[model samples]
Target: MRTLPIFIILLGIITINSCSKDPETDSDDQTKMFTDNDVLEEIRNNTLFFYQGDTATLSAAGNSPHGTFKLLFNQTALDALGADGKLAAGDTFPTGSLVVKDVIRNGNTSFYAAMWKQPSAENANEDWLWYEAFLDGSLLVSIDAKGNGCIGCHRANTNRDFVNSFDLH
Candidate 1:
């Protein structure tokens, strides 16, 4: 009779323990840390230089893309670009470099696209992380170094160190 009570108590304790939340297993909450607002704050605080020269005009034929884009580079990235003022095919941006594109449509800032250099020997082939966020700085997309879409587009610009805006000096 005592054993029956003890077994039931043990089973109840096991159930309670199993139901408790473990931080390590709670990845859903962890992923929320990079939501739109968090990304916006990082961009506002970190980006240093804004490119004011000429804006890249996106074609209206394809997806009716209507935005005048401006480029912004963090200090580290600007320093990497240097005085000669062009990123060459062979030139590699240092790790921690960041470049951002701010898109304006109808005179209102629409969204931002950013690339961050986070190179490691293990992933040297594709070293940049890609991020996109709304004008309010809400994160729309974030792709790590191994991401496909950003790398695929950038691969075409391998001659310009995987950056399409080599002339944005």
Candidate 2:
């Protein structure tokens, strides 16, 4: 019957759609596009929006991996902060938010640290995907890692969803 053929076609379409891969959930793809050298390139090209319009915010995090740095945020993160660039303690950035820390040393930059909010049941970084890498694309914390070393310090700002700059600054 013609109806039987139509049902088969619809089933095939549903199967294909259901099996399609979601780019956002793929760790490999996220690392390639967001956490790797492409991000360094973006920083070098000055395409990212600096947070709170601050060009160079001296890193309060002293004698550590991060030296002098500038904070940058995507539109989603900016919206979470509102026009005042302030959030009451415990406010968390929503999914799709991106935050970057451009680390500079002696007028030369060689590291780009970032966090992207992607909620998942296994996420341990407060639903954020942690990424910290050097300019050469070497990873300090791989995309698949849970970011334990990072979360340790970030816990100081636990109320701010593990982000320190906005709350401390």
Q: For every model in order, what is the number of clashing pairs?
A: 3, 0
Full-model lDDT, candidate 1? 0.63
Q: Kindly report which residue stretches of model 1 are placed more than 4 angstroms away from their true locations once superposed.
A: 1-39, 52-66, 120-125, 144-146, 167-169
The global C-alpha lDDT for each of the candidates, from Candidate 1 onward, is 0.63, 0.70
Best prediction by lDDT: 2
lDDT (tens digit, per residue) of candidate 1 on 32-97: 222334435657888467543335544223222324666777878888775555565688888777
TM-score of each: 0.61, 0.67
| Residues 1-169, model 2: lDDT tens digits | 8799999999999987776666666565544233445434544554467777778666655324677888888777777886767555768888777788878877777687887776652443567777788877788876567676787787777788778876556
